[model samples]
Every structure is written in C-alpha cells, then in structure tokens.
Target: MLVLTRRRGQAICIGDNIRIVVTRIEDGQVRLGIESSDNVTILREELLETVKQANQSALSSAPEAFNHWLNQQPKAVDDAGNTKDKA
Candidate 1:
C-alpha cells in the first residue's frame, strides 16, 4: 500500500482519469473527494466485502433451490416413457 501525508485540498492522481483529493480533516477523521469516469465503480471496502459475501451465499444455495423447484414441476413423461400431455 502506498501511504502519503496530504493536507486538506491536496490531490493525488491515479492513471489518466482518476483523482483523489483531501477535502476535510476534523477530529482525527479525514474526508476525501474522488473524481473518476462515469463507468468507474467506487465502493467502500466494508460494503464491497458485504456484497461479495452475499453473492457467495446466493451462489451456494442456488443449485439446491433449483433442484427443489425442478422436482416440484409436473413430469412431462410417465413411468412407461409415454408423453403425458393434457389434451
């Protein structure tokens, strides 16, 4: 990690399009302002981790839930292999 001391209004540039600026400092808390393109996604670390965990949980449960749903559907064939279509 690159660490630098920046006072209020100081700015740092990343690549060609992204910029991070120190906006305010008060009571040992620092506020930052970021500038980037419209396509860029900016997320807090804790919020990003929460989203990752939620995605993992959803993926883990998906197969079992899908199988259960499939089992509940009406069968398209009979035990003798004949098509069971309602006329």
Candidate 2:
C-alpha cells in the first residue's frame, strides 16, 4: 500500500484518468473527492468485500436453481429451433 500525506486541496493522480483529492479534514475524519471517467467504478473496501461475498453465494446456488428450472421447462422444439412450452 502506498501511503502519502496530503493537506486540504492536495491531490494525487492514479494512471492517466483518475484523481484523488483531499477535500476536507475534520475531527478524526478525512473527506476525499475522486474524479475519473464514467467507465471507472469506485467502491469502498468493505462494500466491495460485501458485494464479492454476495456474488459468491449467488453463484454457488445458481447451478441447482438452473437445473430445477431446466427440469420444469417443456422439451418441445418449435419451428424456429427454440424450446417452447406445451400448451
């Protein structure tokens, strides 16, 4: 981890398009402003970890759920070569 000290209004640049600016410092809290392209995704570390765990849990259950859905789908082939439900 690269750590640096910056006073208010000081900024750091990452790569060619991202910038992290120190906006304010208060009692034990530091506020930062981030500027980047719209394609960039910025997330807090804890929030990112939570999202990763949720994705893993969903993926683990997906196979069983998909198989159950496939079993319930009708095995009829339509003229367009697509699976269709029997009426």
Candidate 3:
C-alpha cells in the first residue's frame, strides 16, 4: 500500500480520471470526497467484503437448494418425454 500523509483539503490523483480528497477529520474519523467517471465503481471495503461473503454462501448452498426445489416440483415427465401418471 502506498501511504501518504494528506491533510484536510489535500487531494490525491489516480491515473488520469480519479481524484480523492480529504474533506473532514474529527473524532479520529476521516471523511473523504472521491471524484471519478460515471463508469467507475466505488465501494467501501466492508460493503464489498459483505457482498463477497453473501455470494459465497449462496454458491455453497445452491446445490442443496436446487435439490430441494427439484423435489418439490411435480414429476410429470420421464426421460423419453412421456408423461407419467400423477398417482
């Protein structure tokens, strides 16, 4: 990580389009203002981590969920496209 000391109102530039500026500092918390193109995505680290964990959990349980759904579905067709008796 490239660490730099920047005071309030100081700004940092990334590449040619992104800029981060320190907006406020109080109570040991720092607030920043970020400028970027409309296509760029900006997310907090914790929010990104939460999304990753939720996605992983969903993927891990997908097979079981699919199986449960399949079992609940009506078994109306056979492998050869023949309709099976409902009884």
Candidate 2 weakest ten by summed lDDT = 78-87
User: What are the per-residue Cα lDDT tens digits for candidate 2 across 1-87?
Assistant: 998999999999999999999999999999999999999999999999999999999999999998898788768898899977664
Candidate 3 ranges beyond 4 A from true positions:
70-87
Per-model TM-score on C-alpha atoms: 0.73, 0.79, 0.67
Model 3 clash pairs are: none
lDDT of 3 by residue, 19-77 (tens): 99999999999999999999998999999999999999999999999888877778688
TM-score of 3: 0.67
Instruction: Judge candidate 3 at residue 43 and give its lDDT.
Output: 90
lDDT of 1 by residue, 26-59 (tens): 9989999999999999999999999999999999
lDDT of 3 at 37: 97
Models sorted by lDDT, best on top: 2, 3, 1
What is residue 77's positional error in candidate 3, in angstroms? 7.1
lDDT of 3: 0.93
- The most accurate candidate by TM-score is 2
lDDT, residue 22, model 3: 100
Greater-TM-score candidate between 2 and 3: 2
Q: After superposition, how far is residue 78 of candidate 1 from its true place, in Å?
A: 13
How much lDDT does each candidate structure score?
0.92, 0.94, 0.93
- In lDDT terms, which candidate is top? 2
